[model samples]
Target: MTQKAKSRQEIAEEFGISAKTLSRWILKEKLQIPQGLISPKDQELIYEKFGKAISK
Candidate 1:
């Protein structure tokens, strides 16, 4: 089975953050988050670690 790939917009929406802010966080925090071609498992991990910051 194949998995669907997520776009930056989708990821941002999932975390309730703007795409620009998400971009900045990637560079500023040096997050393990991948922009394109990310595996579902890894993306979930990134969200688990970084999604909380979006609320603050």
Candidate 2:
């Protein structure tokens, strides 16, 4: 089966934050990111910590 993927923008949108902020968090190890997209392993962890962002 193919793995699912989510862009930085989508992940940020889910946390109500900017992509830049998410990038910084990844750099600082504040967020769990493997690369350009959020890995499936970290998806649940992210939502557990930050919940969902209000999409416009």
Question: lDDT: which candidate is best?
Answer: 2
Question: Any residue pairs clashing in model 1, and if so which?
Answer: none
Per-residue alpha-carbon lDDT of candidate 2 for residues 29-50, written as tens digits (9 for 90 to 100): 5764577666766766665666
Candidate 1 wrongly placed segments (more than 4 Å): 1-3, 32-35, 52-56
Off by over 4 Å in 2: 1-3, 27-29, 54-56
TM-score against truth, every candidate: 0.58, 0.58
Worst 10 residues of 2 by lDDT: 47-56
- Residue-level lDDT for 30 in candidate 1: 74
Residue-level lDDT of model 1, residues 1-56, one tens digit each, is: 11566666666776787888768866786767665755667566556667533422
Q: Specify the poorest-scoring 10-residue window by lDDT in model 1.
A: 47-56
Our model 1 lands, by Cα RMSD against the true structure, at 5.0
Q: For residue 24, what is the lDDT in candidate 2?
A: 81
Each model's lDDT comes to: 0.65, 0.69
